[model samples]
Target chain A: MKILVIIPAYNEEENIVNTVTTLKEKCPDVDYVIINDCSTDRTEKICEKNGFNYISLPINLGIGGGIQTGYRYAYKNGYDVAVQFDGDGQHNAEYIHDLVKPIEAGEADMVIGSRFIEKKGFQTSSMRRAGIGVLGFVLRICGGGKITDATSGFRATSREVTKFFSANYAQDYPEPESIIAASVSGFKIKEVPVIMNDRTAGVSSISPFKSVYYMIKVTLAILIYRLVGKKWR
Target chain B: MMTDLFRMILLGGVLIYIIVIGVLMKKGKMNLKYSLVWFLTGIVLLICAAFPGIIRSFAKLIGVYSEVNVVFFLGVCFLLIIILSLTSIVSLQSERIRSLTQTQALLEKRVRDLEEKNEVH
Candidate 1:
């Protein structure tokens, strides 16, 4: 199967090289693309210097848009499966194969590499964990299946799901919202336990001040998707 | 009762608003399609100022005590509509921009790959 790993990077100069290097070393056979999201820092320069496969967006498309671009690339290149790996070094590259296995076997259309299943790795803070719990409950009520880590960015998509995302993706707070979208569209969703690390470098995208807004936005997005998401045959 | 002075002032304001919109359209700062709404708003205000009785009667029909209050109500409603339309326009533009950026990035990568291949040859 032709698999593509998409690393969406924005101002991730500190962690970009390490993330890409680890992925290359761990998954030598997998093709990867680094989406340099119009960073103000030296992310693009680093990608160019290291000869990493990267795409520099002309404008900042935010996290959701950046990942959608990756899906678009994957679809255009005829990739059978695509995996989203964070550029912040929080996601492990070793579990990529595990993430893709369900999709390859046609058991699931999307496989989320969840950190809460085994309750291993960085479990995040209590406050954030509570928020994620609430989101998980909301997803369950919305018929989005039992997603343990609703905010896990580590996920793999089958070609059909990848195409769906390329055509329609939430611009803000996409992680939880997308699961609802896929489920409503009648796509199989599964989760596998995976270990993650605390981001070693660079600041997190979600700040404390934004967390409240993030929670409300994601919850609403989930409900909205449930209401409007149409099943694709 | 609408005072003559207030009527003159309202007329002047409406004219100035229309003129400003015309200038913006001429300078290409605003699309004519978008400016049409503003123009229609200006003309409606012009009609209301020219014949204050229209607003007075409408205010009575709506059970508003004052004609000025009716004007304010209409103004608020119009502003809300314009703001909502502006937001929709922004959403459409951003979506288009995202599509364009993705296409451009993919094309750039393909060109770079072709160039690299030529170099290897």
Candidate 2:
């Protein structure tokens, strides 16, 4: 299959080199592109230095817009499958195959790398875990089920879904929210048992304050979207 | 006659909007606070346009007389504040709306994906 790996990054110059090196070593044949969302840091320079194929936006478009750009590239180039990788090196290359297997087999429209699905060694804070649980409850109410890993960043998509997400992807903390958009547009999704490793270098974008803010904002958004999201569809 | 005709047409359109908002209220499309704002804003603008002379009288009563500069300054300030308020209303929901939509979409897509995987198995 013509697989395309899309890495949406923001100020991860420190971890990106190792991240790309590992992915390349693990899957040499797969095509990969990094969308460097306007970073004031050395992210773009580092990508160029490593000779990795990438697109650098003039201004930071956040996660949603960055991923949409990747989807668009995949759709235009006719990739049979596409995957989203993190710049922080939190995603394990060992699981890339596991994440992509369903899409390659035509079993899943999209496959997510779930940290909680296999109960691997990775651990998050208790407060964050509770926040994810709350979000899980909200998703269940809206979509009629539950996911052990509601906010996993690693995922793969089929050709049909690449076009869909390219046309419409979320920005600013998009992992969990994107599932609903895909579902509404008539795409399939699956979660695989995979381990997400700890970040090798650099800091995570999410903080305690941002987490609370994210929870409140995203919850309100769900209520509002349930009321008016159909207009766009 | 042409001016009157144009005014009537515009008024008809505004009145239609007011009616639509009213129906939305009945359907629970809008809550009490927003409904009140839309209702009052619609009425006030319509009244101001319908009676243009009210502007001069009101301006004079506000102690500006017919002084164009004072009235213009105050009008500009009011317009600026109104624009700022509208922007806030839009931005207040931007991040929240975005996250909510994404989360909801993720849930729906995940189920569909899992079902498809099962089919292949």
Please tell me which predicted candidate would have the highest lDDT against the true structure: 1
The residue pairs found clashing in candidate 1 are none
lDDT of 2 by residue, A1-233 (tens): 89889998899888888888988999888888887877889998987677677777655668877787777778877899899998888888777788788888888888888777767767678888888888778866877246667788889999888877766666666777777666656567888888777778888888787888999887766655555555223
Task: Score residue A152 of candidate 1 by CA lDDT.
Answer: 93
Highest-DockQ candidate = 1
Candidate 1 — which residues are off by over 4 angstroms?
Answer: none
True lDDT of residue A74, candidate 2:
83
Docking class of 2: incorrect
C-alpha-based local distance difference test score of model 1: 0.92
C-alpha RMSD (angstroms) for model 2: 13.8
Mark the 10 consecutive residues where model 2 chain A has the least summed lDDT. A224-233
For candidate 1 chain A, the 10 contiguous residues with the lowest summed lDDT are A224-233
TM per prediction: 0.95, 0.68
**How accurate locally, in lDDT, is each candidate?**
0.92, 0.74
Report the Cα lDDT for residue A194, model 2: 82
